[model samples]
Target: MSKKLTIGLFGYGVVGTGLYDVLHKSKTVDATIKKIVVKNKDKKRNISPEHFHYDKNEILNDDEINVVVELIDDADAAYEIVTTALKKGKAVVSANKKLIAEHFEELYELQKKYNVPFLYEAAVCGSIPIIRNLEEYYNNDFLQSIQGIVNGSTNYILTKTFQDNLSFDEALKEAQEKGYAESNPILDTGGFDARSKLQILLAHSFGIKTVPEDVFNVGIQNLGDLEIKYAKEKNLQIKLLAYAQKRNEEEVAALVIPKFVKSTDTFSTVNDVFNGVKVQTAFADKQFFYGRGAGSLPTASAVLSDISALAYDYKYEYKKIENSENLKLTEDFNLKVLFRHPSKDADKFQPYFENIEEYYGNKEQGYFVGDISFKNLKEIFSQNSEEVSFVLIEVLH
Candidate 1:
């Protein structure tokens, strides 16, 4: 019989409760979920357990609990929970991507120092086990590229734009209604959510660290309807990709953007809110992992995997931290365009002028409307100019 590893669940939300239920449901339970800790000082819930505690201090002091399952996803609070757990020599399993991306290096170091495992299988592509696969098998393989529909919200939006002929706005609104997107959907659609996951992916795959801001990211916000329309005609699809690959020797890169994927590719066929991750490992060749990618139970399943692994490592006293840099492999570049918000707005615009002859008659770049609110002809404008592109307008006579 496996030693019963005790767990203290830190969130009573969907994933948290779902994990608790899953623990009970699995007959071959290797770990015992002994207690639950939540931050409802005055509120009541359907949660049972007279052992429940509202105070974090009280919760962390419990000696019986040797593992923590962190589903309370706020970055700041999660740092506290994880740190306290590590300090107490308790292992952790977290589904909070934001917290993990921000605190991974610190957490990894802490885990290494304390000789405890920090498992976060639920953070990126949920239940895929892609991270474990990459860390274990592909470390010695030369990786050419990583392309994926890592975010379900943008996938749903783009898929709608293709299949239902719905506008981006329309699709986004529908997604919002379906609970597929949050009220503040910027994180999902605007590429930050995927970028956060990209950091996690890159850290494990490349043994490198990146801040979310470091990823070369461009959201699907500015994609005009015409491009979406054109891509469909060409039998291609647009997927907001979370990419992390090697750019050069000793240099790694990451990107988050809407990219043109050919229709012939299986990734293009993967539509309507499903997520897929394509791997370009030398030995494995072209392999993909696809699924719901985001949800309560699906995410909980990955968390349970982490719980299982963390429990296994704790029970057997396994060497949980395995560094992958000792192997020989070439890192591939992640090609992409980047975006930066304006430092200065309406008062004084820094103009950016382009030599239109560069693009010539490239309709893919823009069109020659011959109307000049926006540049109809990209002439030899000064390279020092600020605003190169503007909205085209016409005057009524």
Candidate 2:
């Protein structure tokens, strides 16, 4: 682990290019790039052609390459590359959240079996070092809850929609144009991306391993004028929040949904492409972590930090996971929610949610504020997804 790192980098996309630039400019890390794997050899890149390779074996088979950095977009392909790299006894670094989150257990097993370091600090919150803090800093503390706006693209879109007076579509278009969002932005807007990240965090934050599907998630895609108007009237802002809290002594509840945040709340000030994480612990109280959540350089910086840590023989020990024999992931909790829809569909929902706390509307449109169990929330969302806008009402004690 002390020898100079010979890196085999995969995918010369945005993050890849940024990593190359940062590595070359960095004088502290004693690492050199041996080869970079790209899908299309025909695509013109600024780097020398000799550094790029289309075949994965060229790096996988190279005994000189000691580190493998995987930054690809495809989860399947990234999985193949990472497994091959780890099996070859090479330390691995990756920033693919979807790949890492979906295959976390398998990858953890691989790292243990092969006895190699596999670090992915950029997978969760871009430049924020929440993963490292969760592993090293909060190792002994009891966590009560972890919540924040983990998705930057949605935050940017929401900021524009609220502050800039732009529609959701317009804000999304701007984000895509600025490289803040993907070409197919469903993963970001649909809450799937945040859910994947939350899946990874739950393991570190609460020692709970759960699939992304198991976590109840509702995105900002269904957001419209009705929800925005209501929030403005209430002097609140809407943020797509990822939440994981201790429901009791043994179970932890997790969800990714839009929540109504008051202007005085700390999360309300976390806008645009910046990411914010609020961790509530037993002894430390509340701690805040904030940084750029998107863009090439910010993410690449995190990747670089992991690469640097490799020089010191640093790898996540996953202390919380080893001690989590009784902890479990659960959804047995009630959430205060605001449901807005057209007046015509009122009956479609009222029969389901009998415990309505408040109701207001006319012939054209209407809404209700009440509490719903996680089970019923999922059922209602599945049936009336297009007709309703559901938002979590953040009630302070």
Candidate 2 wrongly placed segments (more than 4 Å): none
Model 1, span 93-119: residue lDDT tens: 887889878777687778768888788
Model 1 misplaced stretches (Cα beyond 4 Å): 41-52, 314-397
Question: Residue 263 error for model 2, in Å?
Answer: 1.0
Q: Give the lDDT of residue 138 in candidate 2.
A: 90
Per-residue lDDT, model 2, residue 7, is: 95
- lDDT score of model 1? 0.67
TM-score result, candidate 2: 0.96
lDDT of 2 by residue, 1-397 (tens): 4558889999998899999899989999989988898999789898778888899999899999999999998999999999999999999999988998888889988989999999999998899999999999998888899997889999999999999989899999999999888889999999999999999899888887766667878888878787788888999999999988887889888889889988988999999999999999998899999999977889999999999999888898887888886999776777777888788888888876647888878777888888777777778878877776655555411
- lDDT for each of the candidates? 0.67, 0.87
Candidate 2: lDDT of 236?
91
